[model samples]
Target chain A: MPLVGNLRDFALHDFLYLVDRGYKTGSLMLNRPSTDDAAHLYFDKGKLLSVVRPQRRERLGELLIRLGKVSPQQLAQALQTQQMNNARPLGQILVEHGVIGQRDLQFCIQQQIEETVYELFAWRDGEFKFQAGQKPAPDDVQSLVPLPVENLIMEGVRRVDEMSRIKERIPNNDMIVRFVDRPQEKAANINMTADEWRIFARINGRSSINEIADKIGLTPYAVSHIVFGFITAGLVEVTRPTGGQSSKAPVAAQAQRVGSTPTRRSAAEPAYVEPPKKSLVARLINRIRGL
Target chain B: MQTVKMVISGAVNAGKTEFIRSISEIEVVSTERKATDETRLLKKETTVAMDFGRITIANDLVLHLFGTPGQRRFDFMWEILSEGALGLVVVVDSTRPETFRETTRIVEFFNEMRPAPYIIAANKQDKDTAWSPDELRLALRLPEQVKVVPCIATQRDSCKNVLLELLYEIMETAKEG
Candidate 1:
């Protein structure tokens, strides 16, 4: 079990290489070739656990362009025009500028997908490394390829459901939720009932069950029932928040106990401030001042 | 006429302000002060918002160079500065290897901002015991696409080379799009 430095450090080719070789359990640490900053990629039985590229620090656009969705001219013009106007992306710009038609752009994107799959398939130089459990289906081309945006968005929504459940149980201040619900997934799952779907929709990982229930005008009990249904469907699972502590405080007496500490005083005092009361005449005058 | 937004970023005390001053035609406005922390050992003071410098490269091309604040606390300004940047030039102190993290963070931040093209200038390359561009690139683990140029920001020729590399990256980005 020799560990590689940073999975992120590996190029797309290297990542595909490990997967093709059937190396199931290992982490790939990725560091920029000329910088100290690094990111990690955890693989569980050849499945991606998570990719943690810090916020505001990944070059997804570069990757997208390299994949050949748009030409360099399109990117440059988009960037230059964007600097002046501050509207739209290079992809959109290409479409607007009539440099590349919508159909051509879409075709290029589709080609990029096929190319990525081909690259992943050609991971091994020359070896057929198959493992014991669940041999990947030969025709099941989906597994070898990167998940589509639709699938990734669905996974994101599922995680939000799990997060809401854990937040309900813990109600701890350390809980800070990051993922946004996938609207595309919600659009796809239109078959579910409105109320049932509302539960999933409201569970954005940032909102607790109670908060979600309040938002959707459902009782906490009703929300829990809908949540349980989602869990039974194998759509979600519970896990501790990624960072050691949750940012939200627990809703019970624990808040009081935590508040008792001097260090925690700074965290609690902000919520306790009271607005000064005004007399009825003063209130009326204040309201009338605007008129 | 096309306006190209360019960001200038580097580790603290890496002559980011002075670099801007050397090239900028406008008066450099900054609060000059003594070194406050270990960052001071490398250089002193910090850019708070973003240091803005404008240059007209050609009749139709106006390059707006935005310098970012070096400290981690000012990391938030990166998003604001990089809104529509065509590329970034990350200045590095070849003399101080420890500032590599700060430089990396800035580079990462730029990558995330918008697929803005970027180049790294191993600033102060004229100084004692400077690492070669290859060594710096290997040590920093920069992406293959990113160009790292060795230069002394204080020298006009060195600064011109750094600017030229950035222009080259920007042109390449344009051609690729």
Candidate 2:
């Protein structure tokens, strides 16, 4: 029998605990109403076997590179070899070329799974359903160790707390975080993660959070995660953009590529925006057809 | 003065940023980051939020071009940006047939959103492997009213032409409205 209910009635963490305690083998799904996207967790018995989310297809090679397990040049070389012979997965190619060990690839996969599961903690309002007796394919089980639900719940709570802290300081991606002057004594003892330091070195005030992340070769999420820590510690200042020049200046300054003096919008041009309308496209098509 | 806000949307690496940069009078404001997962395999960086760019017309009209992030996870941004926009331009990489379904879904998503008119820019026409406009039209199964214009997003003249085609459609849409 399949169990179905709103997440409001039973929280995701509770549901996960129930499944784990029951020692059941099945797939648990959450339909997040906010994004209209669903998250699927496949389990074999009491242990979590894997996770599937909407539009999430993280490649092993890419995840490895992001985690600093392999260099970009090494990935390129492995890719070239794969193109020539064209027989194996990129992860296999990397291992065969000796760019990364099998153990490292396994670690990245595990981390990917953990991150995917942790992300679901953000979906507060959703419908959850569990269908029993469903199992993942044998191939999907490759090198995957059974993840205990106790660990996931604890980690998920930590991530949720961290995320809310980050969101409080960083409203959206365009908001800029600048390095403020730190007291000399406090600066000496400031603890910073590898990612935090990388983001710290690039904070020039003019660059938005997005630009800083691009320069450091990290995702905005990774950068923001660290910046959030800095914000909580009073080590950095986040400046909310007023939706205009403060946001556009850095781009304009760096855009020497534009080649010539570009004129701004003339005074006569009004920044008028239309009101939102549902089924506007369908209406236009009908009006155009004179139907 | 007249103005239009058109969204430039497509799958990752379909050249949404490049297309905006090709013709915008100023540097484009982008919310791009290093691709973390499978998407990074195709391109090193991906847009997470929205990209802002613009072009000026002779009649004192400013076209505010907002480029929507291509990845499906950022689909919510598409809804937010598409609201109140006069038009949309769906740019698809003609060289990659696999991205067609995503492009179709994005187009349909917008069509369901509002009464706004849109054009499909069949980008990467410079590459020999790219599909021609007619083949692309059939593959996408677009209605006869929607125009499919072949474009090379990196080329200034090509990008300008595609925007011009969209401009015409917007004019017709305004006339009807």
Candidate 3:
């Protein structure tokens, strides 16, 4: 469908949906926000053929470590040894040394597809464009397996688009918008139910899709659908989550309070306790004490 | 004053180190040994890692020239050293036309790293029937922006011409920057 919107808005599932629906062949070009350079994803049929991005090869070792095939210490040691030998790739060396099993290494290589998706989504700037093509080489021991590139691209686009919609509803602008460029006003008179408006307000550019989902106690996919609807109506905009601006801290604090609460409280106990009225002197003392 | 770093790269035994030695004001720092196998027949020994030298063109401008090991085995290091370079001087051996593929690969690798300015010096012009600059460009399929300078690395004035072409390219890059 001529790769709509920015690739950063959609997530991995969206791409899979497209592929599953049988739209195959063509390259997907992804442009990161605030950057002119774009990454190209070549797809043959429903399968990914290759990914071309500058400086991406350097992250292979770090990606392997994150996948749990090799320990951080092992990677560090391998790098140190590589400075001396300079012949083999660090992953191959680790596999040879028995630090990680071949199967585990293979699994990590497979996981690279997802990791690539996450990395591409994490990009605050750049563009991704996808073009359709023939079916790619089948995944085998000899051939490299293609990741669900379309799914990742779709997920990123969906998230960014949703966040942009939510930011529009919250006029305060206190929250930092990460993925999308800037806050855009939603069209007035757009049809939105009261619940959708509440959901929109909570998007606030501060809460993640997960956070918004939990606050209203809805599934992430359902919340995504609502956000998508809001986006279509011009009631909100989608933005990518920025690093270190997570709303998880507040959620975690609330969780801790819930965890520490006593299970039972007497029904006879007063539900609301009113403070006694105080004189001017008492009020001053009370204010001081509160401070 | 900003210091600009440039890498001298080409195929194996393409006189990459020799070209650096000719233009550099200080003595070239290199590790050279007799060729061990078929490498001996091709040229002599090969540079292992890189060769470093400095040329102080003006009081404010100091060009740090790095000559990369020409063998394909050392291809990984190309990304490491080319990180912050201002330009590149691709030294091609006119004697061996078949090395053009490797020359193109090196140029493409540099182009991927932030659009740096580049010059291709087709060295060994003093030799018998060296290829003309047009012939070399056609064989190499270099873009027009990539200036092709013909030179015999041993000649003092010829080496200076190559350096001047690189300096002009760098100045243009600086203006654009």
Candidate 4:
């Protein structure tokens, strides 16, 4: 089944993160009911391949002509050659015809993709559906190298001023920031800007967002915004620092393990102790199945 | 009698009450009250404290189901509820994207406060707008090992399947240890 929802509930950047992490090959169809307009973005194994809007389905050859990279006659000749070949793409035909350089064509395609995605960031409310295994039209695939969505996610997040959403997770500047377990594996794909990198370096599982901001000389909002990105990327998890807790204690000490024991104990709470034995778990499984 | 507890938690109106009511042998004991906050916009009555339900495995073995309060003001109750639990089932309003962030916060809290085997129940799969389980896994930024089960909490079989999935996860952890 296609993944379907509205942009109001899951924002565009959040969807991009989903696509990137899931390594999904699909076409995301977006529609603005109020404006009666729609946009389509195609991805190949998580990298972006193209963006098309119903109101403005400008062809690559037309885009090249409009940009003065190829004259009308050059595009017409390229189109005629493409018709004869039929198997090759228009951009490839143009490059073979020496009308446009391969580098320039790729640059133009990337620029177009970025522009369309950036424009999509402004959409506040719209319905989005992602159909898996959906491919862009053969002719629509222009970029030799598919655009990785990590940078787009970062840039798109920067454009959003929804501090309210960030505040939902961060809550307060006193909240301590710490890396999630085994972050390096996931962080390999993520590319952080210098501003983000500075914040990333300061996460020691002990420093509060306030302490990190104070140490780096950046405002708390700036630090939190970048930390939000980190959180979104699954590089870290945030928690409120317990009062009177020694800073020297390892965060892992607080990182509770599931089967062996409970990490945080309180006087008011019940022991609720004992990790179930395998025999007991088997009985519970049987009982639930019988139900 | 010996008992094991499994906590069912989610944001407001994610179907916690219905989930418990569907599977519990007894009518779920709940502290539901008329909503006085923004939750009023979603549902007329909200779970303010917690919901309690039970299942009998044998005469001596019973399973306790605790549904954590959905609203943030009642967050203190979560710490109390999550203690030494066998596993956790985090229900997400699959049809409501706005609540996805809130769902993530709940997952983080439980994982931090009392790390245990947990599975996500993508509730409301009966709705056309419900995000697929695969999509919720990504949107929630859950690791690959964590299971995201498709669930319609009103259905008994679906709720039972969610419980079974959590039990299987706990079984794996127990064997590994």
Candidate 5:
């Protein structure tokens, strides 16, 4: 019988830690019940061979085209070959057609896999099932590599924490931001880093924080960090969309708390203490083995 | 060279893709995949990422249109797709009251982001059971200053008018700025 439980009982990170320690091999399936989106993870000897999130599928050709690695015409040609049902994968079709190099295919695969695992941490409510001794086919395993679940836990937890904080400030992606009057002395000494400067350049009364993040080549969370700093410094004011007329849109300050960036604790502050290891590991193992 | 980005968002099957296709001079690049949830009952596919299209109004002016998935799970993409956009056009299925509620969330969601000027596209106006523009505004609890334009997203003239309205808003904003 498969081990099953709600994520609410055992969080994904703690669950992953147990899997890593036991050196177990099997398939772990997760379903966000409400959304009906599912994730499947195939493992061999405690190493992750592959993970499939069918809903988030990005074909190699499309990934290449989006990254500017291949042209649309080239991708179209590759797709035509893939449509013939020759049992060849789309990535293989692109490689055989010389549309994209072998190296590009490998890189895109890693990018795709990493993105899939990274997004999994956002599952606050879901059902997870682990079936022991179930693995992908041999040929599929040949292309698969054991992923470092621990590293994923470390990064995923960090990202989720930071994203939650950033979102509290940004609310959504469309609210508009404009420069506010700053003390001339402080303005001259804005201590602008390269990313901050890039963001500062885009802070006209029109482009949104999302647009500014894109311009600054940072994630929305990172951009929010910088924007929140500006807000605290009284160097910027955020407002709602004016509908292209003179400023009649509502001000973000007066709007919902989601719109304004609250000043957070300084980095110099103390962090939280970790829970005792033995109890956590023992509890996770019991949960994983379906206690 | 000038490129104006406008976001087209709405509830599931509000016809954001159709709206973009109608006015786009070039082929739209869409990343629609099979719907795996309750949305599958409504349509065979949904846009997991975004839909991209472009129109060239003049040698110096071009408009870029991005369409967002309507489902709430993809709300994360709304922020991603709405970035740098000059304005917004929210499409609503006039026959579906629940869709208006979704539109309300979208309007508030975007408003929270950066209050960009937005207009409601009261789509499917040609349908016999579709609600009137006034009814929709009231049901969605929209303020009076917001414009609600009735449209059939599949029709070229209607889509074009939405684009024109956005452009006019952009021009007026530029004058004010």
Candidate 6:
């Protein structure tokens, strides 16, 4: 069954995160109501294989020609050869015929796919339906490696209007962020840029996103954007600063009184002591088992 | 009598009432009213306040179950019901991906308020459209330690299994503590 919903209800970055994490193999068909435009994203085992705009119907050979990487005559010959041997992808034929290098073809296709995704991210409303186990056309495989949605999400979130979504987690500029336990394990696949790396290094569980931005001389939006991406990737979490620490002292103090501390606590701080007695838990377990 | 509480929560129409009704030994006390908001589109009646259910552990021990209202306006009730909860069962309508975000919000609320033992009940697992527990885990960004149990809210055995999984989680926490 296909998963269908409008982007208005579920944001694009979120859906992409679902696709990436679910490792879904599907074609996400998106249609813009206002423009009546349609876009197709093909995925294989969670990675984006290709993106196609039905309106354009622009094949790899045409894209290479538009990129000034291949001549019209070269594309024509590749098309003829591709027709003769329908099994081979046009990009592969172009690479084999020396019309375009393999590396260049891959880079070109990746860029095209990235740009299409970035554009789709800008869309605030669209009908999206994901049909599982749907792959791109055999000839459209293009000899290019499938693009990881993680990297795409990192970039796409930056391009799209996603502060509202990020605010759901970060909430406010005063919210402090700390690394999740086993940070290295979670950050393994994350590809952070120079600016993102700068912001990443500033996270000490003591600095707010605003403070990080101030220290790094970047805007709060830039810092929050990166931190939001980190959060989505499960690399970090946001929390209120300790009591009497910030301008929101009263709220922070209340948080302390309520014992709503972040998961990670210092050695000196009191540990969680509210687990019900083991005897009680065991009895409940036994009772439920009998039920 | 000694009383322990476990809060059952989820988005609107995620089947919280159905879950409690299936397992609660007493007639489940639910303050359901005709839907006035957008929830009317999903179901004619919505849990306006909360649902109360119970199980007897022993002659002197009683287990109380509270189901929080599934509307944003009633979020205040969540904190009140979550107080002193032994564990939490976050029910998710596995067939609806749109509600997954709301489900995550509910989990975050409970975690922030009181980091107690909790398990996700992926309800409506019998539906062909339901997302698997593994997929729900990824979609919700739940950690590996948190359990996501398959469930059918309408089934007595299924709801009992969910409660058992939550108790086991609580037992592990109690042992660690």
Q: Answer with 3 or 5, whichever has the higher lDDT.
A: 5
Backbone Cα, N, C clashes tallied per candidate: 39, 5, 58, 1, 10, 0
DockQ of each: 0.01, 0.02, 0.00, 0.11, 0.01, 0.11
Q: Give the CAPRI class of candidate 3.
A: incorrect
lDDT of 5 at A247: 33
Off by over 4 Å in 5: A24-26, A34-38, A42-45, A49-56, A83-87, A92-105, A132-145, A172-178, A181-291, B1-177
In model 4, where do residues sit more than 4 Å from their true spots? A1-274, B36-47, B175-177
Q: Report lDDT (Cα) of residue A154, candidate 1.
A: 43
Candidate closest to the true structure, highest TM-score: 2
Task: Compose the digit string of candidate 2's lDDT tens values, residues A1-291.
Answer: 799998778887888898789997898878977776887788877888777664443344445555556666786788688789776667777788887778777776776677677778877789988999777543242234677888989888887888887887787667877644431223333433334444654554556776766555555667788777666665567887655525533211232321222322222343344532334333433332331
Candidate No. with top lDDT: 4
Off by over 4 Å in 1: A1-291, B31-50, B58-61, B175-177
Q: Write the per-residue lDDT of candidate 1 for residues A1-291, one digit (tens) a residue.
A: 343433234434455455535746444444454433334434446554333333212232333343334444565676687678665445556678776666665555444333333322212222222223333212111222233333333433444455467446434323222121211232221224435533443333445554444444444445655655554444433334555334332221111221221221121122221211233223222322322
| Model 4 chain B: worst 10 consecutive residues (lDDT sum) | B40-49
Please, what is the whole-model Cα lDDT of each candidate in the order they appear? Answer: 0.49, 0.67, 0.56, 0.76, 0.65, 0.75
Over 4 Å off in model 6, which ranges? A1-273, B35-47, B175-177
Poorly placed runs, candidate 3 (over 4 Å): A1-291, B33-49, B57-61
First chain TM-score in every candidate? 0.23, 0.64, 0.35, 0.55, 0.60, 0.54
Which scores higher on lDDT, 1 or 2? 2
Model 6 interface root-mean-square deviation: 17.8
TM-score of chain B of each: 0.83, 0.87, 0.84, 0.91, 0.87, 0.91
The alpha-carbon deviation from the true structure for residue A51 of candidate 2, after best TM-score superposition, in angstroms, is 2.2
lDDT by residue for model 1 (B1-177), tens: 334456788887777766776665442233343335646424323324335455554454445566766766655455545555556788888888998887887777666545566788888777777878888998789978779998787776676667766765554434211
